[model samples]
Target chain A: MDELTRARQKACAGSRLSFDEALLLYRKASLLELGQWARAAKERHSGKNVYYNINRHINLSNTCTALCPLCAFSAKQGDTRGYILSPEKVAEMISRAMQETPGLTEIHIVSSLCPDTNFSYYTDILHTVRKLLPHVHIQAFTPAEIIYFTKISGLSIKEVLQHLKDAGLSSLPGGGAEILDDSVRQIICPDKASSAEWIETMKTAHSMGIPTNSSILYGHIETTEQRLAHLFKLRAIQDETGGFGAFVSFPFYPQNTKLAELYTIKPLTAWENLKFIALSRLVLDNIDHIKAFWIMLSEEIAQLSLAFGADDLDGTVGEEKIIHAAGAKSGSIMTRKKLNDMIVQAGYIPAERDSLYNIIKQAVPS
Target chain B: MDITLDTIEDKIHSGQRLSKEDGLALYSSNDLARIGQLADSVRKKISGDYVYYNVNLHVNLTNICIGQCKFCAFGCKSSSDKAYELTKQSVLSRIAKAAEDPDMKNLHIVSGLHPDWPYEYYLDIIKTIKANFPLLHLKGFTGVEIMHFVKISGKSIETVLRELIAAGLEAMPGGGAEILDDSIRQILCPNKATSTEWLEVARTAHRLGITTNASMLYGHIETKEQRINHLLTLRALQDETGGLQTFICFPFQPKNTALEDSITRTSVWDDLKTMAISRLMLDNIHNIKAYWVMLTLPVAMLALGFGANDIDGTVGGEKIMHAAGVSSQKALSKNILIDAIREAGRIPAECDCNSKIIRTF
Candidate 1:
C-alpha cells in the first residue's frame, strides 16, 4: 500500500499523528487534501461562523533594552526618536480613539523592554488609561515584557500579572513569543527573553485567568523542523494553560536590517501563509480562536482565511505604527461597515464582537 | 505507485514549463489533489518548500508626488493640503526607532517621485541612513523613484543604483510599476515611470548584483490578460536578468482618491484569484507576498493556501495607503503577528529580509 493511503486511513480514523508524521503529511499531501483536512478540523472545532471584534492599541513606549534585529518599533534610551508614553499620553490617546470609535472594545497595551522603565510605570499607565476609559477591555503585555517588569519589581510573574490585573490589565497580548526556538533567538535577538521564559510567562498568565494570544514568525532562516517545533511548543503550553485565547501567524518583513543583507527577505506567498493558518487551526485544537490579524495579512486574504481555518478578524484598529514602519502600505482603522462588507464578501456573516469573541451585534446584510 | 525521484523530476520540469492551458486544466480538474500534487512538486523542486518573509518597516519619505496617478490615492501634490515629507532628521529618527526592535532587520524605503528633490539629496539620504544604522539592510527606492533619480542625476540606471548600493543601499522595493502594459500605465499613472522604464530599472539592479522584487497592482481597470501580461513581463525580465527575487500582488485600493469617483471597488474573490494565479503563474520567483496592510490580515492568511508564503511583519508606521484611504490594521506586534501565523497553522519563524532565520519559536 502507498504511504498516503495509509496516512489517509489514519486521518480518517481520527488518530493523531506524531509531529514527524504530521510534517510528512503536510509535505506530501496536496493543497486540496490539506485544505480538506484543515476544513474538517475547523468544522469540528469552531464551525463555519468566523469571528471579529473592535479593539485599539496603546503602546507605552518605543524605548527598549534588547535590540532584536527584526524589530521596527523600538528605540534606544535617550534617542531623540524614542518617546515613552507617559500616563497622560496613554490615557489621552485611548480617550480620543475611544471617543472617535463608539463601539470601541479592547485596548491592547504593549511596550519596549526599556531598561529605564519600572513596573510602577506600566501599572500607572494601565491604571490611568482604565481610569479615564472605564468600559474598555485592557489586554496588555507579552510574556517577556511581563517577565522584565516582574524582575524589575521584585515580584513573581503571577504577582506582577495580578497587580496589573488589579490595575485594569484584564488580558495579555502575546507579542514576544517570536519563533519559540532559542537557537534562532541567539542569532536574531540574543538579548530578548529565552524560549522557555516566554512560554513560562504565558503559562503563568494563563493560570492566573489572564487569557492571552500566541504567535509564530515564519519564512526566516529557521529549518522546517524548527517551525514545527515552535508550533509544538505553543501546543504543549496551550494544553497546559488553556490561557491562550487565540493564535496569530506573522511573516517577517525584511526591508532594512542586517539580516536582509545576509538573505533577501521576500513576503510569503498567499498559499503558504494560508496553509500555515489552516494547519494551525487543525493542530491547535485546544485553542478557541484562530485570528488572522488584518494588520499583518491583507483583508482579502484574511477574509479567505475563514474557509482555510481562521475564525477571527481582529477588531478594527485605528492608526497602527509598527508594521507601517516596516514597509506596510496597508493603513490601520477599518470601519465596522467595511469589515462587514469584507465579511459578507467572503461569504460569511458580519458579526460584531467584543474583545473576547462575544457577539455583541450580528448584522444580517440586505 | 511507480513515482520515483526521476519521475518526480520530470513532473517538476513539466510543471515548471507549464502553459496557460496547463494552469486552466489544473484549475478545472475535479482532482484538486492531483493539481496540488503537481504544484507542490514544483514548489518543492524550485525553492525547496522554504517560504520567505522579512522583518522590515516601510518609510515613505514623501507622499507629495508630481504624477497624480489615477489609481494612486496615496500620492499628493506638494502644495496640496495632504502633502507630507519626512526630513533627513525625521527619517533617520524613524529608522532609529524601528532599529530598536530586536525582530526588525530590514528597512524598506519607497517614496513618490518628488519633482524637486536633488539627486544629491537622495544619495545623501541613503549614505546617512547607512552610516547611522550600519547593521540594518537598506532596501531603498522603488523603480519609479529610481527612474526619477536617474533623470535628475544625469546617469544611467546602472550607475545610479551602483552609487546607491555603494552608499548602503541593499536592494530595491518593486514599486511604481502599476502594470507592465503601457496602455494601462497611460490611463492610471500617465506621467509616472513607463513600463519599459520600470523593467529596465529592475533589470539593471539585478545585473548590478542587487536583487529586486517585482509587483503587479491589479483590481483596477486592467484586464485579466493585462494581469497575465504583468506576470509575463516579470517572468520575461526574470528570464533575462535573473535579478527579481519575489513577486508582490497588490490590489488597487479605490477609496478616498481621485479614482474613487470612477470605479466602485475590487471584490475579494478576484483578489484571492489573483493571488492564487500569481503563485501558479510566477514559476521562477522564489516568494509571493499577500501584503496584509493592503489586503488586510484575514485575506492574507487565506492567501497562504492559495499561493502565498509570507504575511509581512509588524509595521511601525505607514502613510501612503492611508493617504489613499486603504484601511487595514497597521502596527502588529511580534506576538500578534506570530499568533496570526500560528492560527493559520503554518510554522512562524522570524526571518530577515533575505529569508534569513531569526527565531522559530
Candidate 2:
C-alpha cells in the first residue's frame, strides 16, 4: 500500500527492489534512518560489535608492468624507485614485526604484480616469513597476484594456493578488485586482473578453506550500475565461499598519477565515498565486517564511518607505502594505545585480535 | 504517503534498501531522471532544501614538512629551496586579502606540519588572523599539523585546540586521511600521523563542539575493503557527537608528488559514481560538497544531479591540493557558481558552513 510497507514486505520476503524503489529510500530517508534499518538487519545477521586483527603488511616489491592508471603504488620495471624485497629481506621484516609486537597475529604480505618475478619467489618468501615467525598468520596475494604466481609456478590456482597454504599462507587479501565490470577495468587497468580471473581466484581460495577478503575499487571510471555489479558479484561469491571475512571499499585516489593527468583533475565527493561504504554494508549480507581504511578515507571519515555501518577499523599500521604513493596524506604507524583510545572515543570497546577474528584482548586501551 | 513510508520501512528491514540490485532495476527501468529525483528527495528529507557551501579561501600556511611522503607533491623539505612557511605577518596579510573579497566568509588555514614552528606559533597565527578578520570563519589545521603542534608546543591536543579555539578557531578540516588501512599508510607516510592519532584529533575536536569536515584521499593502491574501513571510522565518530559539518571527498592529486613515479593515474567516471553512492550512503551527514576545485567545473556541475548538493565555492587562491595540481583556478564568483548550478538544473543558494542558506542566488 505505502512505500514504507512495500519496503518492509521486500525485506521480509528477501525480495529485491527496483533501483527506483531503492532511490526512493534515498529521497525519503536520512542516513541515520537508513543506518538504523541496516543496523537492525546487521544485528539480525551479525552482532553490533565488529572485528579487527593485529597484522603487518609486507609488500614484496613495487615493480610491476600492469601500470594501471589509478595506481600510485606500482613502479615501472626499471624505474629507479622500483624495488624488490628479497625473500630474506621479506622474512626479516616479518620477523621484526613478529618480534617487535610479540602479540602480532597476521602477516599480510602482498606486492605489485611484477612480470620478472615467479611464484617460486613468492613461495620462498612465504616460507621464510612462516619459518621466522611460526605463530603469525599470513594473509597474502590477490587474485591478480595469485594468478600471476600460478602462471609463474606453472600450477593451477588450487595447487599454488595449496603450496602457499602449506608454506603458511593463512588467508587471501582482496586486492586489485577495481570494479567487477570489465569495461571499467579496461579503461583504468587493462593489463591487471580481469573480472573473471579475480572472482575465480577468490572462489578457488574459498574452496580451499583459505578465508579471503573481497573489495571494490569505486569512485573511478565506472557507472552506478558497474559499482552495483561489483557488489553483486562479491555477494555471489560470498554466498558460495562463506569464506569472506570482510568487505572493503577503496575509492580511486586521483593523485599525481597518470589518471589525474588524463582525467584533468577529478575525484569523488565525500557523500559518494560514504555511500559506497554504506552500500557495501547493505549489499554484502554474507560478510561480517565493514571496514573503513583510515589511510585512504582519512581518519575523520574513518571514525565517522563507524556509525554509518562500519564495525572495524584496521589495526595499527606500522608502515604503509602503496596508497601513499598514490597521494594518501594520512601517516603510517599507530601505537596500540592510540587505536584503543580511538575506539573508546567512539564509545566502543576495543578488542585486540588475531587474523582469524579472534580477540586477543578485550577493551584494550593503551 | 503514509503507505509509502510504511513500505520504505519494510524495504529497510528486508535488506533491500539501496543495494546494486535496486540500482540495476532503476537503471534498467529506463527512468534515469528518477535517480536525481530520488536523490534530491533524499536530500530534502535529510537536510531539507537548504544546500550548504562555505565562503572559504585556501591559505596553505606552509609547504615544508618533515615526512617525505611519497604521495605528496606539495610538501617540501624545510631545508629545500622549495620549502616555505608563511610568516604571521604574511599569514595575516593573506587573511586580510581574503577578507577584502566581498564574498569571502571563511578562511581555511591548512599547512604541512612544519618542523620549526612552535605550537604557540599556530595559536599566534590564529590570533593574528582572528584579530584582523573577526567575522571570517577560521577553519584551520589538519590532524597531522595538530599532532605536530602538540609535540612542538609541548601541550596536549585538547589544550592546544582549546587555546586555538579561544583564539577564534572555529573548526578543523579533516585531512591526512589517506586510507584507514594502516598497511597502506605505513608504506606511504611513515613519518606522518597514524590513523589512530588523526581520529583522536577529530574525535576530540568533535567532543569540544568544534565542527570539522572529513575527507578521504582514494584512487590509489588500497583495496575496496579499506575504503569501507575509512568510512566506517568516520561514521563511528559521527555517531558520538555529530560534530562533523560536512564530508569532502577529493581524489589524491599525484602530479609532481613522489608517488608520480610509482603509479600514474585516477579516473573521472569513478568520481561521479562515488558522489552518487555517497549521497545514497552517508544517510547521517547533512551535506556533501562536490569540491569544484578538485573535481573541476564541468563534472562538479554534473555531480549536482548525482547526489552532490554543494559545489565548493570559487577559491580565490588555492594551494596545497592544487600545487599537487588540481583543476579550477581563480576564485569562483557567485554568478558563476549560481550559473553552474542553474546549468545543472538545480536551484543555487549561498549558504554558511552549517548548511544554512544565507541567500538564494
Candidate 3:
C-alpha cells in the first residue's frame, strides 16, 4: 500500500502511525477525511465525551532570568514591571479562590524563573497551597521549572522533584516542551531548557512515581516534519513510561512576542489549528487524550475542535496570564456553565474532569 | 434522495445549479475546510485569480427616520440628542474631502428615512454630488428606501428610480431584505417595507437599467429554509433581470438592538459556511462580497477561500453597523485592503464602486 493508504488503514485500525506515515496523511488526506479518522480514534479513547475541569490559575511571578523571544509574560529582573508574589500574597489568593469556588479541583500554578528566588520560594508556594486547600490537586511547575529548581538548590532532578512532591506538587503542567527539539528551541526559546533536559526532567519525575502531562508548542518556527517528529518522540515516551495523564497542543500566539516583530506573523488559522489537533490525535495513539487549550485557541475554535478529535477542552481557567500576555483574550470569566453549554452545542457530552483525566461530574444530555 | 457533500461537489464540478437541499447539506456539514475548498474552486471558475476591492466612502445624511426597525441602532427620534441631519453643504464637503484621494471612485449612501425631508431634497443632493465630482459613481439607496420615496411622493417605483438616475444616482444597494419573508419581518421590522415591496422595487429598478446589488441580514429569528429561500429568490430575480451586480450577506450583530437581549451574534463557522453556501446557491450572481465592516477583515480574508471575490471597499467612514455595536474599524485604508488580499494568496485587483477591475496589484 501507498504511504497515505497504509497510514489511513493503520489509523482506522487504531494502530500507531510512524513519523513519515503521519506526515504523509497530514499532507495528502482531505481535511474532512482525516477529521473522520481522528474522530474515530478519539471515540475509541474517550467516547463522545469532551472533558473540562474547574481550576484556578495563580501566576506566582513574571520576573525571569531567561526571557525567551517567544514569551511576552516574562519580565527582566531590572524591569520595573517585574514582580514576584510573596507567600502571603499566594496564601491570600488561594484563600480567596477557596471561598469563591465551591467545587474547585486543582490549583494550576505556573511561573517564570526568577533569579531572586531560591528553591525555598518554589517549595513555599506549594506548601502554602497545600496548607489552604488540603485535598485539592496541585498541578504546578513545568519540567523547565523543575530543572531550574535543581540548578538553584544544587540538588539533583530527583531531589528537587521529591522535595516539591512532599511540599505539594501533585503533577507537572507539561509546558516547556516547546517542539521538543533543541534546534527549534535555539531560535524561539533560547536559554531555557534543552530538549534532552526537558525529557530528562519528565522521565525523572515519572520514575519517582509522579504523573505528568505532555504538550507541544507548534506554529512558531517549527516545521511540519518537526511537529510530527515531536509527536513520535512523545508517543515513544508514553509507550515506555505510561506516566502521562494527558497531552495538550498549544498553537503559538505571536502578538507581543519578539518573534512577531522580527517576522510578520499571523497566528494559526482555524484550519491549521483543527488540523493540528487531528494530526496529534492520529499519531499519539498511546496517549489517552488530546487537549484543545481553550485559553490559547479561543472558545469558539475550542468548541469546533470537538469534532476534529479533541477530547478535552483543558479547563475553565479562572484566570490566565501567560497567553493573555502573548495576546490571547480569553482570560478570566469562563464559568463551568459556559463550557458545558459550548460542549453541548458542539454535539458532545460535557464531562467535568480532574487533573488526572478522572471524571468528577458528567453532564447528562438534556 | 440522499444529499451529501459528494453530490454537491459533483454538481459544483459540472457547473450545475445547487439545489436548496444541497445548500442545507453544506451548512450542516462539520468539515469547514472542505466546504471552503469547494467554494473556492467554484469561485476560481468564474472570478479567476483576481480579488476585487474598491476605494469608496459611505455617507449617512441623517438619522431622523419614521420607520422604527428593531434591528436598527442607527436611526433615532428627531428630538433625540443623537439625531443628526446633514445639510447639503456638509454632504458636499464630506464627499469633496473624500474625493481628495484620486483612487476614490464610488459614493455609498444608505441612510435613514428622514421623516421631514421632501423627495426633492434627496434628488438635489445626488445632483450636487454629481456636479462636484462628475467622474465619481453615485451608488446610493436600497429597495426599501425607494418604496419609502414612492409612498411619500405618490410616484411609481420606476419614476423614482429614473429621477434618481437623472440626478446622477448610478445604482442601488441590496439592503432591507433582511430575509425575504414577511412572517419574520412583521415582528422584526414591522415599520419597513414588506418583502414583496422590496423585491418589487428591486425588479423595477433592474428593468429601468439601474444596476443593483442584493443582501440578506441573517442570524436572528430566521430558519435554514428561510435563508436558502432568500438565496433562491435572489437567484430567480437575477436570472430574470440580469441587472443585479453582486450579493453580500450580513451576519446580524445582535448588540445594542432590540434583539440583543434575546440573541447573540453568529460565529465564524456560521459566517464562512453561509458565505460558501451563498456562492454555491446564487450561481447567477457573479460576485459575492465579504463586507469588512460587518464581518471583520480577518474573517473577510478567510472568505476569499469560500468564494468571496469582492471584499467591499475601504468604506472610508461608516456608522450604521457601529451604532448597533459592531467592533470592526470605522474605516479601512486602501493599502490595508490590498495587503490583506495579497496575503490571502490571491492577486489583488483595485476596482471602481461597482466592482469593475481597474488594475491588479
Candidate 4:
C-alpha cells in the first residue's frame, strides 16, 4: 500500500500513526477520511462526551514589557489603554464572579508580562483567588508568566512554580507557546518567552505534580512541516511524562495584530481549522483531549469540530480578552445552556469539566 | 450498521445507488476533502477537467410576489413600497442590451408571483423575447412559477407548461425549492409549492421534453436530514425523468429577510460539503452548478473541485439574490468569467441554455 493508504488504514483502525504517516494522511488523504478516523479516535478517548467548563478569566494586566507584534492585547507600560489590576481588585472580581456564577468551576487566568511589576504580583493574584474561591479550580499562569517570574525574581523555573503552587496555583493554562519553534518565535514573539524556556517551565510544572495543557498557535507564517513537527514534539514529551492534560490548537487570527499588515496574512479558513483539529487528534494520541476553543473558532465551527475529532469546547468563558483584541467577534460570556445545546446538537453528551478532566456533570439528552 | 466512508466508497465505485443512511453518513463525516474527492471523481467521470459557464442573461421579471417566504428577501408583498412589476417594454429593452453579445446563448428569466398578471402575461413576455432574439434560448420561470401560473389561469399544470413551451419557453430555472419537506415549508414558506408539487412540475416538464434544473435554498433552518431528503427527492425525480439538466444549490442569503436576526450565513465548510454531497447523491443529474451569484467567486472556484461543474452564467444582471444582499457582480465583463474558470485550473466550456458546450477555452 502507498504511504497515504497505509496512514488512512492505521488512522481509521485506531492504530498509532507515525509522524511521517500523519503528514502523509494530512496532506494527501481525503479530508473526510481523516475526519472519519479522527472522530473514531476521539470517541476512543472522549466517547460520546463533549466537554465544556464554566470558567471566568481574570486578566491581571495588559501592560507588558514584551509587546509581541503577534499580540493585539499587549500594550507598552505608559500606554493610554494599559491597566494593571491589583490583587484586591482581583479578589473583588472573583467574589463578584462567584456571586454572579454560583456554578463557576474553573478560574482561568493568563495575562501579559507587565514591565515593573515584581513576581509577587503574579503569586498574589493566585493567592487571593485561591483564598476566596477555595475549591474552584485555579488554572493560572502560562509558561510565559512562569518564565517572566524567573527573570524578575532571579528564581529557578522550578522554584517559581513551587511558590505559585504553594499560593494555590492549581494548573497552567496552555498559552504563549506560539508555534513552539524558535525560528517562528524569533519573529512573532521575540521578547516574551523563547520556545525552550516555555517547554522547560512546563516540564518543571509537571515535575512538581502540576498538570498543564499543550498548545500551538498555527496558520501564521508556519509551514505545514513546521506544524506537524510541533505536534510531534508535544507527542514526544507526552510519551515521556504523560503530563499534558489536553492539546489545544489555535488558528492565528490576523486582524488587529501587526503581523497581519506586515505580511498581509488573512485569517485561516474553517477548512484549515478543521484539518488541524483532525490532524492533531490523529497524531497526538497520547494527549487525552483536543479542545475546540469557541473563542478562537466561532460557535458554529466549534460545534462542528466535535465530528472532526475535537472532544472539548474549552469553556463557557464569562468573557474573553486576548483573541477578542485581535478582532474576534465570537462574543463574550457563553451561557452553560448554550454550550450544552451546541454539544447536544452535535450528537454528543454534554460533559461539564473542571480544570482537570474530572467530569462535574453530564447532561442526559431528552 | 456502522456505515463508514469505506463502505460508501465501495457503493460509489461499484455504481450502486447510495441509500439515505449512506447519504447521512457522508454528510455527517468531517472529512470534507475525502467527500470532495468522491464528488470530484463522479464529476470527472462525466466531464473531465471541463468546467462549464454560459454567456447567459438573468432577468428577474418582477418582485411583486405573494409567496412571501420567511427566507426570501426579494418577494415583496403587492402593497409594499419595494414591490414593482416590469412592463414588457422594460424587460425586452433589458434583454436587447445583452443580446448585442453574439455569444449570449440564454435569456434566463425567473420572478416572484405577481398577483395581478394573467397567465398570458408570462406567455406574451416569453414569446416577445424569443421573437426578438431568435437565437437566444429562453430558459425562464421555475417550477414554483409554473405552478403559480396554473393557480391563477385556472388551467392544468400540463396545459400551463404546454402553452409555455409553445410560447418559446424551452427550459425552466430551478428556484423555489427551499427544502423538499413540508414541515419546513409550513414554517418558512407556507404559500409556495409543497414538496410534492415541485417534484410534480419537474416530472410533468420532463415528460413534455422541457429541460429543467433542480435546486435547493439551504443554510437557513434546514437540517442535514432534510437536506439529504431534498437531494434524494431531486435524485429520485431525476432518476425517473432524466430531465434535470443541472442541479443548483443556493446557500440561503438571509440578509434583509425575516430570518436575518435568527439565522447566520453558513460556513464555507457546509457550503462545499453540501455541494460535494449533492454531486455524490444525484448520480443521474449530469451537471451541478456553483452559481457564483449566490456563492461568491472564490467559493465557486473552490466548488469546482467539490463536484460543481457549471458556474451558471455571466448573470448579466440578477436582482433576486442581489436584493437579498448578495455582493457578487450584477454582470461580469467579457472574458472575466473565462479568466476565473481558467484560474480554477479547468477548461472553461461556454455552454448553451441546457449546458451544451459551444466552445472551450
The candidate that achieves the highest TM-score relative to the unseen native structure: 3
For A260-281, candidate 4 gives per-residue lDDT tens digits of 7778675676657877899999
lDDT of each: 0.74, 0.72, 0.86, 0.86
Q: For candidate 2, lDDT tens digit of each residue in A175-266?
A: 88888878888888888778998988888888888998888787766777777777777877887779898888888888857777777544
**TM-score of the B chain in each candidate versus the native B chain:** 0.90, 0.88, 0.98, 0.97
Query: What does DockQ come to for candidate 2?
Result: 0.04
List the candidates ranked by TM-score, beginning with the highest: 3, 4, 2, 1
What digit string (tens of lDDT, one per residue) describes model 1 on residues A124-202?
A: 9878978887877888888879888877899988898889999988888877887888889887778878898888888
Order of models, best DockQ first? 4, 3, 1, 2
**Candidates 1 and 2 compared by lDDT, better number:** 1
Counting only residues 3 or more apart in sequence or on different chains, how many pairs clash (N, Cα, C under 3 Å) in candidate 3?
0
Best by DockQ: 4
Q: Interface root-mean-square deviation for each candidate? A: 6.3, 13.6, 3.9, 5.2
TM-score on 0 to 1 scale for chain A of candidate 2: 0.92
TM-score of chain A of 3: 0.97
Reference-based TM-score of each model: 0.57, 0.58, 0.90, 0.82
TM, chain A, every candidate: 0.94, 0.92, 0.97, 0.98
Candidate 1 ranges with C-alpha deviation above 4 Å:
A1-3, A8-15, A261-267, B1-259, B271-361
Docking class of 3: incorrect
Q: Flag clash pairs in model 4.
A: A31-B31, A31-B34, A32-B31, A32-B32, A32-B34
Stretches of candidate 2 exceeding 4 Å from the true structure = A2-5, A8-29, A364-366, B1-48, B52-348, B351-361
